[model samples]
Each structure stands twice: as structure tokens, then as C-alpha cells.
Target chain A: MQYDFEEILETIKMTEIEHFDIRTVTLGISLRDCVDRNIEVTKQKIYDKILKYGKNHVKYASQIERQYGIKIANKRVSITPASIPFDSFKLDEFVEVARVLDKAAAEIGIDYLAGYSALVQKGMTNGERELIKSIPIALSETQRVCSSINVASTKAGINMDAVLMMSDVIKETAERTKDKDSIGCAKLVVFCNVPEDNPFVAGAFHGVSEPEVVLNVGISGPGVVLDAIKSAGKIDLQQLAEVIKKTVFKITRAGELIGREVASKHGIPFGIVDISLAPTPAPGDSIGDILKAMGVEDVGAPGTTAALAMLNDSVKKAGLMASSSVGGMSGAFIPVSEDQAMIDAVERGNLSLEKLEAMTSVCSVGLDMIAIPGDTPSTTIAGIIADECAIGIINDKTTSARLIPAYGKKLGDYIDYGGLLGKAPIMDVRNLSSNNFVGRGGRIPAPVRSLTN
Target chain B: MFISYFGKLKGKKVKLSESEIRAIAMQAINELGDNANPELVKEVVEKAIKNSEYVPIPETQSQTTGRVILTSFGLNHPGIVSNVTKVLSDANCDITDLSQKLMGDFYTMIIMLDISNSPKDLSEIQNDLNVVAEKMKIKVYLQHEDLFRFMHRV
Candidate 1:
């Protein structure tokens, strides 16, 4: 036999019992050429382009899934940032684009279509300003359109003006969709140094430099990593890291193969395989569970950051060795709602907002899928976004805030969207005011680290 | 022939046989006539290659033998192997290897099959096996060999 019996059994066990699966196979279609002078013509072009390239996205993904017997969780799409091509549009016109995106997503049979976005890391254009203003209405009105705003980067510094506007946008999005526990906020992400090739939704966008169409994948297998760690009980940190790397390497290889296969099926170029160990709401598929298995008492324990740093590092090292096309946010995601154990920690008071922020410093993204009190002021939200941006710029890594201020919901309450978004306990946010600091709207000059040249 | 010739030329390390190069040169001469300088011959050859239909290699064709691992398990009972193999035989699948283990009334069997020659695809075969599994009260899984090879073999 070419493969050992135990090896075959292990592969089967990972898929069947360990919750190992490809998190998403996101098809990135560029809409740069879809722009037109007339809003109606532009909408038609956008719709036609998406349908032409993406009509078979779900069908092809399912066929590949059946052939490999590995489940692909989500078949989604990302487009070029709307502000880039449709920069001449007004606020209402941008909302119309979002509606078309939502309709195309439904027609193509996908749950989410991202890249209803603006990249204002350095500054904003009049169109970008209008697009940012339209996000709340676009999100409130559409079902599948996910929006993101990039407000900071290492080279361009933090766009405090964009950050403040996004803060208000998040608040308004929550308020407008209050009927559904502010679910609109769940689909909005505020990013710092956002990856152009990120396959993960609520933050994914087809970078300007990308080809006309591409397929990027996000791999998820925290359950597999957790099992490997539990089985390697009593080992030293070095050996434990080896276990994680081995597990992550195999999964990354599998992920790359699946990504290539899906792209080949689409007859488009294969982008990158993001090795982020994105957690789901399932029981064993929690990054927090992996952290606990690594000897943390809970997610907020003193040694939690060290454990996460080691795990995130091992994942990247293994992923680099496994595949050369690794891009996107290739680290462990600590979203409060998506991971069951993380949610439990928040509900039990073992995990707090501050600890999560600290964890984000070493991980892929920041303050993800967290539900806070409705009355948490926009200035405080801006303060939170600024803090996350500071960490990202200083470290020169990608960070984001997907803070959902569930309208009228306070601490001790829960915002349960169920399914993949899962549920998050309304975390406590300090009442400290940042009205004076964020009130001064200007770009934070690029940090000294940005002077790499 | 023209595509392979053009592909080799594009690499700029021409390893064509004498006859092949002569054929290309003759064609270039025929096309360029009195204008057949080195650069003109090159341009004519390039245009001919571009105009020819270039068929891309089919990506779905597996580089390795199209083998699949089918694993089935259930309470130990008679006729499980016979019934399952019946489906494979019906699909014209070649069972290359088989192993079975019984651990106190529970039976697990792993079968290696070459399905490249089968008329039905993997999904169709799975659907057939699923019916047998449901009737016999067992669990069966069919997965491509590449998945195992990629994960376990470096």
C-alpha cells in the first residue's frame, strides 16, 4: 500500500470526528471594469459579471466536495472594493450597488458576498466617504452583503477620520437592525492593514493587483489541532509545538489541494490558501479548546497569550513549509461568538474584552465577533478601534474589530444568531470617555516602524 | 506538434530534433518568402503558433492512479462483504486490496478500489453504496486516494 493503515485512519478520523473542514472557498471576482457612468448600467454590469463568473460557484464547489468526501463549509465570493471602481457614486447609489450584490449572491446561491468596502488607510475620497456612509443602510437593507473599512496600515498610519466615521456606522448599523439583535453589525468589519487576498468573509476583498478572477481558500481545523494536543499529553512545549505543526502541515496541504482543485474546476487562477485555524460554533472545533489543551486554565489565564503566540507561530511555520501560496490572515482566530469555548469563557467571566485584545496582538485578527452593550458610545467604539489599530501598526500585523453593539442589549445579556455566527455574551466595556482624543480628527502619522526603507 | 515546438522555443533553450527544426524553418520560409530574415522568420513562426488552436491540458485528469479508499463498518453479520462487493462489481470497480478486523461483534473493513475504469463516477458509486449501507444498517465512506496521499505523504 502507498499509505499506511494508521495514516488512512487518521485522515478519516480528522474529517469524520474532528470537525476538520475547509472553512470557505471564496471566489474573488474583480469588478474594476464593471463601473459605468449610469448607476443602472453599472448595476447591470456588476450583476452580469458576478453571474457570468459565479453562476456555477456553488455547484462546482459541491461537486469537488463530493469527490473528495470533505465538506466545504461555505461557498462565497469577494469583489474588488466598491469604492475603487464606483467612486463616482453617491451614498444612495452605493446602496443600490449593495442591493445588486445581494441579489447576485442569492442568484448564485451563496450566503455572503464581501468587498462592499472602502480602503481609507491613508485618507478617503469623496466617494469613499459616501460609501462609508452608505454601509449602515446597505447592510440593514441587504441580507448577504458584508462590508469592511480599512482605516489603518503600517505605511499610512491610522485614519482617525475614517475610524470615527466607521464607529458611527457600526452604531447606526446596530440601531437600524435592532429588530434582529443588531445582526447587521455582525456582517460589518473595521480592519487595520486588511489583507487584499483574505478569503474570510466580513473582511475579504479582491486586491487591485489580483487577476480578473481567482479562488482563495480559508482552512479550519481547530478540532484536529485540539485532538493532537490532547493526545500528546505530558509532553514539553517543544514536542507539543511539533504536534501542532505536524497537524497543521497536513491540514494545510489538504487545504491547498482542495483550493487548487476548486480553482481548476472554475477554470480560473488559484489564489492563496489561508491557514487561519478559524473556529466554528461546533463543540470540539474551538481555538479556545486548543488553548485549554495547551495547559491554560481558561482563555483569560495569565499564560494564555504565550500559549496563543506559540500556537500561532507554529501554525505559520508549518503552513509556510506546507504551501508556498499562503497569504491572507494566516493565524488563529479568537472570535468570541464563533468559538464555543470562547463564548463560554466570556459568559463565565473568565474571558474579558481586554484579554481578547491582548490575545489579538499575537493572533491573526482582533476583537472579532464580540457583542457589546447597545449604549456603548461611538466615541468609546472609536477608542476601541484606535487601540486595536495601535497594536496592528506597532507590530505591523493585520488587526480588525467586528464589534456588534447589540441594540438595547447590555452586559449579562446574550445576542444569539445561532448557526455559524453562533452567540456572544454582551461583554462589559469600560465607561471611560475618549470624546476629547478621537474628537481631534486627523491621520496618525505613519509610525517609525514604517520607515523600513 | 506546433504547440510543443512553440513551447520549447518560448523557453529559449531549443532542444528540437534536426528534422523538427528543419520543418519549422521550411514552414517559416514558405510563409515569409523574400522577407525571410531571422527576425521575419521568428515573427512568422510566432504568428503561426498564436493563430493555432492551443488546447489546455484537462485539469481533472489525475496524475496518479484514480484509486479510492472505501471503508465500511457495522455489527458483525453475514453477507455484508458479499452485498457491498456486489455494488462495486456492478459499477465495474476493481477491488485491489481488502482488509477486515472484527473486534467483538463490530466489524470494520477497508477496501482499496481502482475506479478509473468504472462507468459511474465516485458520487454515483457512493450513492449506490449508500443504498446498500442503509439496507444493511452500516456506515460507509468513499474518499479519493489523493486526499490521503496529500495529508500523510509529506
Candidate 2:
């Protein structure tokens, strides 16, 4: 029992990586207890919960990072869906609750406030309907309140009716405020049984099972893994795993250092770290490189999905072993505009919405950062989003739609999101109509198995 | 004022930049000793950057956030602290904080901070760090604070 822990610290200090650091240590706090008989009381409860929980999180996360010599990328909070508590309340109450949540998030130095959401995928709860009704106004008025509605699911099959409602909702939300569309896009999302622990926004919300002030970290290193695969060519799957495992292990360590330090600094209990292959439209860091390293000529080639499945699994396997706690939709993302490889693939006719959808089956989420014809009908757009949601709900993973209807683009035309979002070519979808199917408004009922078991 | 070359490889035609052709020429002269042509080198670099990332992964990862965590066993071994810190110090991972404690047979440590000029992955560096840990007979783990929080939670 000769302990030399400080010596280990010296070793880590010797060879630090460059600017790479943990992006976010989000605290997912369930606010179910905040429900109340009076609207004013409920608002206060929401405010109090966020202020107290958020205040301690950043401080704690910072403390841990300081000890381990890592950086915490961001501090944010996600709460229970607003639909549950504001279900019976009026639009004014919804607005009031949103204001309080925004103020709390700001006070605690939290950058993102998620969970100002409603779910209307299968059937509209009275609360769900009201939340949806207020989305356009809430997003226009509130500073930090982001909202999402579960528009469709695969469990009970696609809710075409919900899709139609959501279609109008998006259109109206977009049109309601000219200057706030970015905020609109930032605030609103359409999901399919989205994960409860997602650290990314405009969809993060406290799930029923999450504890108050529980922290979750998101790790990104497509650049590192891509480079490793590049150097280790034509190797066996095991060899590939070895290279990736080594890379992921190191990246996860950096993330863990940040998370633990932040937790200690804030004095709250440390939570799980998520190892997601997050990508941006930056020049060189794309998950597409993994596919390229696997010998794909272009990212969306025929074998793309299979390649992604292997990459995603390999990443998870290595990440899960590195740390005891792992949460969030920890998978490789295929956001077309957010990855340079994907953007090039789209531009060069090697990628498409259909191809992206096919790839999503083996990955997480669908049609992210995809641009479509602006004239694309609301029903058709909803149908597309619904199809993506169906994939998530049936599979029981988080799925989201971030389709951007480029203001004046047509199929084959290109729109640039400038920075991080990159640029994308508009993709085509089937011209057939789903208007009739989407017109019906009612729950399709939960999947049969969920009810029985 | 520079010459450009066009070539076909893998059934795709590419227009090579003049500078690219020169680099190719330079490399060819070094390795192939004039046997390598300017056109060939341009193709190689263009293909290399396109088929793979030009920047190393660890270098790219280092750009976002540099958060860390430190765990220490105890203070029994008087010279242990200096020895433990050498590894991270050598790798350029900035020591943000140091948490050390002494248990019966093991001294525990947890450190948190951003790594400055760290290689692509922390785990890759761990083996090197482990060499120091092994010499001291102590177990060591390196992690990003974000990732560390994720791994430890129930």
C-alpha cells in the first residue's frame, strides 16, 4: 500500500492535448414536483428548481475539471416537459412559466434551457394540445425557452394526423416572427420519443427517472477517430477497434476530467458522461471520415449505413468501458450540413434525403441539417419528419428532425448555413401527397407491447 | 507563373494545383530520386487529404474545451505528488486542480484540467502515463471532465 497518486497527476500534466475540451455538462433535473394547483405557484416552483439546481452544477463541474486538468465546454439544464404541468393552464400561464425558466437559466450561467416542450405524437393530451398552441407565441416572446413536440412514432406506427398539425405549427412558428427564426429554429423541434437525457438542444428535457442536478457530459472527437482510422488502413475489424478504442479512450478521459472537475467545483453529485461523435460543418472534423477510412468512395455510398453501424458500435464499446456511467444518444451522427464530407457528398450527387434516412436506421436520429425545397408543402414536410420519428420510437432511441426549409431554395439548389452548419444541397422527396392522412387528429394509440408489459 | 498537371486515378480525373505538383516533385526527388514525376506527387497529396483528414484527431479535439479532473489517494508517500504530476506536466495537460488522499494500501488521486497541446486521445497518453504510475506502483486513470462525469454516474 505505497500510494503515489500525485505522481500520476504529474504524468497527466506533462502531455496535455490542445484546445479540445468537454463541450457540455448538462444537468437533467426532473421538475415533476413543481406541478401545482395555482399557475403562479407552479411558475415559482419551476424557477426555484432551475435556479438552485443550475447554480450548483457549473460550480461543481468546474471544481472537478480544475483537479484533473480538463475543461468543461458548457453548463446547461434540461427539465421535465412543460406540457405535463401546463396541460390545464392557459397560454398566458405557459408564457409566464417560460419567462421564469428563462430567467433561472440565465441566473445560473446556464447557456441552454430545454424542456419547455410538449408531446403530441400519438394523441394530444389536453396539456399537449395547449402547449402546441402556444409554441409560436412562446418562441417569439421567450428568450431561452425551447420547445419540441413528439410529432410521430413508429411504435403505434406513424401519426399522419399529428404530422399535419405539426406541419402547420412549424410553418406558423417560422412565419410568426421575421427576426426570430433562428430563435424559432433553436426553440422548436419535432421528435420521436426523444431521449430523456439528450444534452444537446432544442430537445433536452428532464425525464421522469432523472434525479435533480444529475450531470451528463457529451464527448466529441470525430477528428481524432477519423485520423486514427486513416493511419491504420486495411486492418482487421479488431485492429480497427484497437485504434478507435485507444482514441475514444483518450477522448473520454478528457471528457471525464472535465465532468468530474465541474461536479467537484459545483459540489453536486457527478453524473454520467456521454461519448457522442458530435460533428460540425468545420473543415476537417467529420464522422464521414470514418466511412471514408472504411473504404467508401463517398460518404452516402451503398455500404454507408453498415459502415456507420460498425463505427457507432465500436465507439460505444470503447466508450462504455472507459467510464462506468454512459447516457444520451451515444452514436455517430450523419448530419449532412454539419460534416464537410457530408456536405461535399450532397453537393456532388452522392448523398440524398433517402440515402440519409437509410443511414439513420443504423445510426441515431434522421435527416439532420438537411435542406429541402422551400415550397415543400407542410403536409409533406411533416410526413418526412414523421417517417424519421417512426424510426426512433419503434427502436426506443432518441430521434430528431432539424430540417431547414431554405427560404428560397429548390431541389438541386444549394444553401449555405455559413459557419458550423456548413452548406447543403436541397434534396428531393416523393411528390405524392399525405394531406388526407395527416388531416386526421387523434392518437393512434401506444404500441401494443408497451401496453401489455 | 506555375505549371499545373492533370491526371486520372481510380477512374476520376483531377486537376492538380501548381504548388501541389511542386510538393509532389520535391517528395519524389527525395524518395524516388527523380523517378517520381511532378504529376504523381500532386495526385498523392490531393488524394491523401481528400481520402483522410489532414489534421490529426487529437489536435482537432484539443480545440473545443480543456476540462480535467484529479483524484489523489493520500499523503503517506512524501515524494509521490511530484512524481505523479510529471506525466501530465510532460504531456502539456494543464493541472487545474489536484485531489489527493491516502487509503490503507493505496494513495488515491483525481486531477481535472485542460490539456495544452495534448495528443489526439487521453487514453493513448495513459499508457505513457501508466509507465510513470507503474514505477510508483499506483493505478492511474486520465479522462475529460465531461466524459469522467458520464462514466462514473449510476
Instruction: State residue A61's C-alpha deviation in candidate 1, in Å.
Output: 0.7
On residues A26-92, what C-alpha lDDT tens digit does candidate 1 reach at each position? 9999999999999999999999999999999999989889888899999999999999999999999
* C-alpha-based local distance difference test score of model 2: 0.68
Q: What is the DockQ of candidate 2?
A: 0.07
Deviating ranges (above 4 Å) for candidate 2: A1-19, A36-41, A56-67, A152-157, A177-183, A393-396, A408-425, A440-453, B1-154
Q: What is the DockQ of each candidate?
A: 0.45, 0.07
Model 1 interface DockQ: 0.45
Q: What is the TM-score of each candidate against the true structure?
A: 0.91, 0.68
The digit string of per-residue lDDT tens for model 1 on B26-79 reads 888788788768778778766654554444343344224669999888798899
**DockQ-based CAPRI category assigned to the predicted complex of candidate 2:** incorrect
Q: Would you list the C-alpha lDDT of every candidate in the order shown?
A: 0.92, 0.68
TM-score (chain B) for model 1? 0.63
Task: Show the lowest summed lDDT stretch of 10 residues, model 1 chain A.
Answer: A1-10
List model 2 lDDT by residue over A1-453, tens digit each: 122343344334322322345657787777888889898888788888777767766676655554445556567888888888567877777878878888888888776788888766667776777677777788767667777777655565556666676677766665664443233553577888666777766677777677766767887767667766877878987788788877777677667666655555554566777788877665457888679888789987988888888888888888887777777777777887778898788778888788888788778666677777767788888777766776676666667777666555578777664655567777776789977755564555545546533
